[model samples]
Target chain A: MPAYVVGHKIPDSDSICSAIALSYLKNAIGEECVPARLGELSPETLFILDKFGFEQPELKLSYAGESLYIVDHSDRVQGPDDIDDATILGIIDHHKLGDITTSTPLECWIRPVGCTNTIIKMMYDFHGVEIPANIAGAMMCAILSDTVIFKSPTCTTADIKCVEALAEIAGIEDPQALGMEMFKVKSAVEGTPIRDLVLRDFKDFDMSGNKVGIGQLEVIDLAIFDEMKDDLHADLAALKEEGGRHSVMLLLTDIMKEGSEILVVSDDDDLTAKAYGKATTEGRVWIDGIMSRKKQVVPPLQDSFAG
Target chain B: MPAYVVGHKIPDSDSICSAIALSYLKNAIGEECVPARLGELSPETLFILDKFGFEQPELKLSYAGESLYIVDHSDRVQGPDDIDDATILGIIDHHKLGDITTSTPLECWIRPVGCTNTIIKMMYDFHGVEIPANIAGAMMCAILSDTVIFKSPTCTTADIKCVEALAEIAGIEDPQALGMEMFKVKSAVEGTPIRDLVLRDFKDFDMSGNKVGIGQLEVIDLAIFDEMKDDLHADLAALKEEGGRHSVMLLLTDIMKEGSEILVVSDDDDLTAKAYGKATTEGRVWIDGIMSRKKQVVPPLQDSFAG
Candidate 1:
């Protein structure tokens, strides 16, 4: 029977690239494996695939009735029947596992690296598999995408090693240049919808008993941020209504400004004000020097939410 | 003068992480440094920052009027005025450079690695900087994101090593698990507008002679795919119109199905039909065994576009 490689949800570059690269590696090893994508590829991911000349993975929106070699995602062992596989063949991922149990012993490789693409690359290297430039570029982009070009605190030394080797094969002297070009290609933000721009990279999380959605937008000009502020405010208000969350946060970060103007929309003005360090009459709060919401904002918010 | 840590646009995890990690490294060394995000953070990225306690880097959408440190991006000596910078203090990237001249002729660490984050991680390790667990998790996530969890063809030994080292520090036994969790957290995919979903990870590219936009959607259930297929189709058509691309492609990948139903929308029916081997007549095309677009679909599409 052919093995199926499935990535986690919201298939980011790593999820897509890992499935593809691993399938390639599995093929190299004489295993008939298929790369499977579990969700939609974001626009940023499309750019990476196009730059590297890779095909988007086949989308698998439903796993309710299928056999899959899981990659990058798994539900808790005791949780609801998220996955109904009797036996899990292999598991590869890099996140904290809740309660996972495999009835049939599985071959699972879970590393604490930034991207699954790195693991597939290592497997190929460990087995002496040669990589094409396009694949190399795709994987490179995946790593950069996941590691924040190696700025995120989650990066590991192994990720660095993989990047170095792949960079050589890709014939890239400055991976940053390639990354920059890829980013610039995406900077042509005209003609894009305001909602699309606002929700371009949005994520929803269950925070402090409230379903919260956070959206981020990146633009070259800080002035553009001001131009979009009013629209953004309206968007946040609409998103809050649509998302049905206690609060919805939008971080209008000016990379050049070296700070972020955080917009908070919520019915609980006190919570929003407390989160922003000031109360807003319009139930909106703006905070500065608040770039890392996870580090600087979420922690305090989590506390406030608890309080 | 304070040194600026510049990054690329549409900044990936590595781009942002490298900027932040490098800024931390520079600050440790007593250099006046600030980490600047060159572009926006994708939804996937915001989640990563949240997962590991880190703040998003200040968004720097454009390099038009700002001083730049030129991290992960550079311009040729004769490309355009936007490419030239008088205050380029340093450059840290992983791509190949084409004739770049720094006005100040400063330090340059241009490595052929999978991610710039890997290099910055090396700096932190070399300097014996104690990274917090949150920072470590962020770095590890960055590596996984960039390297596609070590599967991308671009992964290098250096990237692998960086991830491995950082994994130990981050206290993660399996990075793939972490990556999966991160991906799952991102893949909620409930109540998202069709346009937002399409553009979330969308990328625009000049393919052959035509501009194209490609988007990927990964899901755990194929059933949801069926439900969203029509909306997705409509969204693709709108994407083509709004983005003004000759073609807009959306990949509905069912990981469990081990196959993909590709939807291509374009004014030129022949282009769409030829790319997928046949047109389904619904302005859609279906392709089997089409996981690696880079390895499978793109080449044929490029040829067809050329033809």
Candidate 2:
């Protein structure tokens, strides 16, 4: 069987594009590689595929009995269903590694970059493989999405350089124009069910014995949050009860402000106070100058939960 | 309690210097950090420490009470004895990660470099911390020792840059002359017992539950092997049998040629053949361009063992 390249479940634009681009580059270098996805593609990801004129890769639940190359995420919880049994040939990622151990040594290209597509771009440069325009366009969109158009703290100089180079290859004259277009598709969830909206960009983490879920939404203003605050609280409370999660936090992030107004519903009230170092105002708190969840949110929460 | 930084169980010149240098840098930045060791010091390490007018750090079987920042390694077999109980704050190393997992996320700096000191040098440069002469001299010597004075296949352009910068700070006009001086003290193994000499730079490994020990001796000539072949074989056989090891391999590495003539004493005859993909000629085989045990030796053998 050919090697399948995939990203984590709950596929974002970055996960989808990186899998497509990395598998393409690997196949270009005479390797048997195919892009695969673990879950249903988001609407923004579909928009990127359509814009780039590329077909969507096959969806997969488990890749057992096949050689695999994982991208975008490293945590076993966030990976495919068969990640525990699959023969992981390599990993290309940009996150804190989870509990994954290989029987033998494999190439692990994990960096503290804003996106895995940046690392994949570095790989293509090192191997002298020229990425096609479609792949380049897809990767460029992912970078813009993940880094919040270079406004995120995770956006490093390496990522900035890659974005400039990829944009030129993809014939994108104005990144802001493209970014706004993608965000328009990204935030077109006004009519989505409250539970689905909360889980659109959600991830679960295990802190000690607590199961915690965090969901984020990008919006033009906080008025949408005001409009649906009660329903969101009810959904989060019900979801927490159903999943046995100790806490649930939602980030109603404003794209222009570069901050997250957090709304937390938890079984333990002191958990939020300990995690953010302050008490919330009626289940809402403000975190100014916070963009990326991995760098800003996860570390502090894990530290508090450990304590 | 302050954090303690240490290397692997068999502390080499590079491991010792890196631990000391990193601790000092961390302490300078206002973190309570101390240098530590897990094993007895090698003669070459002692020579460098004495030459730099620095004292050896405290030897520890395990730092169970304090959080750790491991410098040179992360494998459980090579970590502190109480690694399972001790909380790890971070890891900075240059090796393939073994079966080690953290409860919460922690900072990990793993790079494909020649030496851990090289990574620490980049750290100091990035942080803009000035290195004192003694620390600079110690780190410089470690870079030279680990890279075999830039002759080993593991040496990269980054290692070369670190050597040049450190040589200037350490006030060494000629690195090669100093390298020879260090190596003379480094290769003084004639008077030691055969067992001690063979285990001078040794590491134990666990590959799919198979126990292995590989030791390397960097020498100016193979005449030493001709002199001690019989005694070395007797000791390795006794050690393997007593320790219940699957196999033990010794590499008599020639510094000038960048090659290692391997000698195997195994309970399983096909183990070496399967690992190396070639039959040994009467208990010996020469690998012409092998340098790094972590990169070159461990991966292929682990793959063969897993298969």
Candidate 3:
């Protein structure tokens, strides 16, 4: 049976693009490879793939019981039964790895690069595989999405080299121009439901023994923030219920101001105070200068949790 | 006199974050620096800045006769009168330079990197400036916005280094996780006006002697694409009438699929057919593999225009 390349659950651009690019690269090197998605793709992912003229890979509910080649995400979240019968082939990712259970791994290449797309692009370039313009565009977007356009700590030299080479082929003089255009298009906020806005780009993090959810939404009208404040707070409270967590915090971030008003709704004032360096008796804390929940919020919470 | 760092018109994240980060770096290096915005920030940028706890830089409606340092945007667009008595000190940008008369000696640094935030981050690291978590998050978001999280081709090694180092300081384990969250938040589209959706992230390009306008919208639901088709067509037709000698195209792109249904609205069927490689009398071209207007759409149109 052909080895299948499986990405993390909720396949991201990095997972999908890397799988496609690397699968093609591996196939070119005479290896039977298949690109597989661990879950259904989001609309944004579908947009990117459609733009590049690539089909979303075959969706697999679980990587368990199949030969697995993982990308972006790790297998730590998967049950043992999921991968008990599966042979591990290799791993390629930009994220920190969790524990792996595969007994006989054929190859595991985990680089702290900005994007898995960069790695796949390098693999294709190293082997002299000609990437079509559309694939190049997809890979470029994947890299942009993964590294935050090379603003993340995960980016590597290899990632940059891959993007430079790809940029030349793609005929883009400025990626920022393209990105700005993309982001502007992506920022259409007029028609979305309040629930969708609240849940649109949300993530759950284990913070200080409590599952804390962080969500961010962008709006053109800052007045919209003022208008939506009450609704957003109610939504946060609802999210806490839905997530069954100790608290849920939403950052009503304004990109122009370069600052954020932290919206907190929780029972534990101590946790909020420790996490935000301030407390409110109203179960709400407004924090300034708080962005990068991963970098800023997560670390501090980890410290408090550990303490 | 303090050196004013001015960004381009219609300031994006790169322009705003780069201005602030670079100003801080310059101040650290014992230079008088002030961050300045050239225009009103877009809604997405406002979200980022507010999230990071920074005030939006003072907006300068017109740089008329003011000596200023340019970042992200070019000097040419500011017009001769705006830069008349202005001493152009330095320029840090990621775009191709248009024709501009430099009155004073300029230390223009134009790299093909993904974002000006990457450049600003590099300066911060080079000068050994400590990045606050807020600044780091802002820069990271800027990079994510500019490079589409490193999926754009314009990213460079410097961009990767800045992001990697910043990510570590910001304490983010995986920037992609954050990016995915951000993009998801950004992709929500429920109540946005069809006109606003069409123009939110719109750009114009000269393709094969025909000026072409391209717009993209990131919506959470795929059904919206189908729902808005008729409105979009009517809007495009109206847009064409109120335009110069050019065609308009919109990509209701599904990012997950990395593909797009390229909608072309043009009176010139020949130009449309040549650009899309097929002629449809309906004035709409469905391109299977076209994303990145710069790479996939613009170049082909440029070639066809030239031909």
Candidate 4:
């Protein structure tokens, strides 16, 4: 059977694009791999696929007893529900080292970078395989989305170089202009349900046995969330209760301002405040220069919860 | 301070050589890296180093508050005692996906190969750095020793190809002859103390909270250990009690015979028998075609313990 290349649930552009691109690379090297997704794609991801003239990957939820190549995330909580039952053949990720153990040896391409596609690009170069133009476009867009147009602190020199190389291959004249167009589509939260908005890029973390859910929504301006803070908090509280989570958080990120207005609904009062060393006013705190959740938010929250 | 690149405790040929080679590559890439060791070198490793005209690395015990780049192994139990206190910069290993999680992102070069030196050789190629003749010789010896002259089940095509390339660079015409010479040095056990013999190539694993200690001694003939089985078992029992380990076992591997005689001293009776599906006679069992402890032995023991 062909091995499945997949990404984490609640798929974002980087997660979706990397899975497709890596599966393409693997097939080029004579490995039969199919790109798959664990959940529905976000609007930004859809926009990227559409802009790059690519179709959405098949949604495959259950992975028991199947060979898998995981991309974008390594944490067990973010993976498929039956991930432990599956055989992980490899991993391509750009996150922290997670709590996954294997009985046998496996290939891993994990680096401290902004996007998984950057590493996939590196793999393509290493294998001397030329990436198709459409895949290159999608990969470039994914990097822009993850790094917030090279503004996130997680954006490294390697990521920027990969993006530049991908942009050349994709024939993109103005990546920043394309990035703005994608963020505009991502910012359309007017008709979106509060629950959908909160879970657009949500992830759950097991921090010392406490389940903490964090969501991020990046827009050109934070003012788009001004009228929905109360509804967002209500939905977050409901999500916390429904999932039996200790805390739920939403970061309304303003890409232009390079800051985030955080909304916290937690069993422990002042959990976010304690984690970031800032006082919360009515369950909300605005922090400047907090862009990457994997780099900045998750690590501090994990440390605080452990402490 | 320069980041220290060290291998696991109880330094083996692959561990010591890969640490030195990787540090050399990292320095060539304009990074300050130093080779170090957590324990004394085995006679096999010493022989390889002396033949390659290299010096032993400095022994460093504490890793608290220092930058580290781990080589050869990723298990927390195999690392320095204060590993949790240190900032892990990266890891290069050829084992299973271990339980080492990082708060920050780090580079990892893990593959399903025979030796860590093979991966280091790939890194050298990736960075466009040239491997020195002495380091190349040492690295080739490491791969030869770990793979048992390409006879172990863990050896892959990548390992053989790398050894061939390294042999050309090191001006060695017959690597198998050199491999035999190294095994002769590794087979020396008459003059060594029982504890020293049992702890030469030993490692510890935390399998579902059970601390398991395993050691392996590779020799050309099983007859070399026929007169010392009882002594080895006694020393293993004492080591188990001294370390408060759940079990301590040793593999007397006859490389020529392509098998191992396992000596088990466990708190729970018949644990090894149940793990390997073989009956134990007098705390020992000989299994044909069992060479790699990481690939063949530890996985089953981990499963049995978790089961």
**Cα misplacement distance, residue B45 of candidate 2 (Å):** 1.1
- Residue by residue across A43-118, what tens digits does model 4's lDDT show? 8999999988888898999999999999998899999889888889998999988888787899999999899999
Sorting all predicted structures by DockQ, with the top scorer first, yields: 4, 2, 1, 3
> Best candidate per lDDT, number?
4
Clashes of 1: 181
Q: Record all residue pairs in model 2 with backbone atoms less than 3 Å apart, i.e. clashing.
A: none
Residue range with the least summed lDDT across 10 consecutive positions in model 1 chain A: A96-105
- Report every candidate's CA lDDT: 0.63, 0.82, 0.65, 0.92
Report the C-alpha lDDT of model 4 over B197-260, residue by residue, as the tens digit: 9999999999889999999999999897878888889999899999999999899999999999
- Candidate 1 ranges beyond 4 A from true positions: A1-10, A38-40, A69-91, A94-113, A125-130, A153-158, A219-222, A255-259, A270-307, B1-307
Model 1, span A1-307: residue lDDT tens: 6667776555666777878877887888897887877556667778887767877777655545444566654433212244643335565665423224332224445455766777677567656788887788788877766665665445678777778778998888888666556555444456667777666656554454577767655333456555666777888889889868778877665434445566778767687566557665454454655554434555466556655
Q: Each model: TM-score of chain B?
A: 0.71, 0.96, 0.80, 0.99
Model 3 chain A weakest 10-residue run by lDDT: A96-105
Each candidate's DockQ: 0.01, 0.16, 0.01, 0.84
Model 1 scores a C-alpha lDDT of: 0.63
Can you tell me the CAPRI class of model 3? incorrect
- Interface RMSD to the true structure, each candidate: 21.6, 4.3, 22.7, 0.9
Of the pair 3 and 4, which is ahead by DockQ? 4
Q: Write the per-residue lDDT of candidate 2 for residues A1-307, one digit (tens) a residue.
A: 6899998878888888988998888888998899988877777889999999988889888877788888887677788777656778777877766666665435567677888899899779757899888889899999999888888888889888998899999898987689888887887877788887888788888776788888888765667677898889888888899889989988888888879888888877876678777778888888888677787788788778877
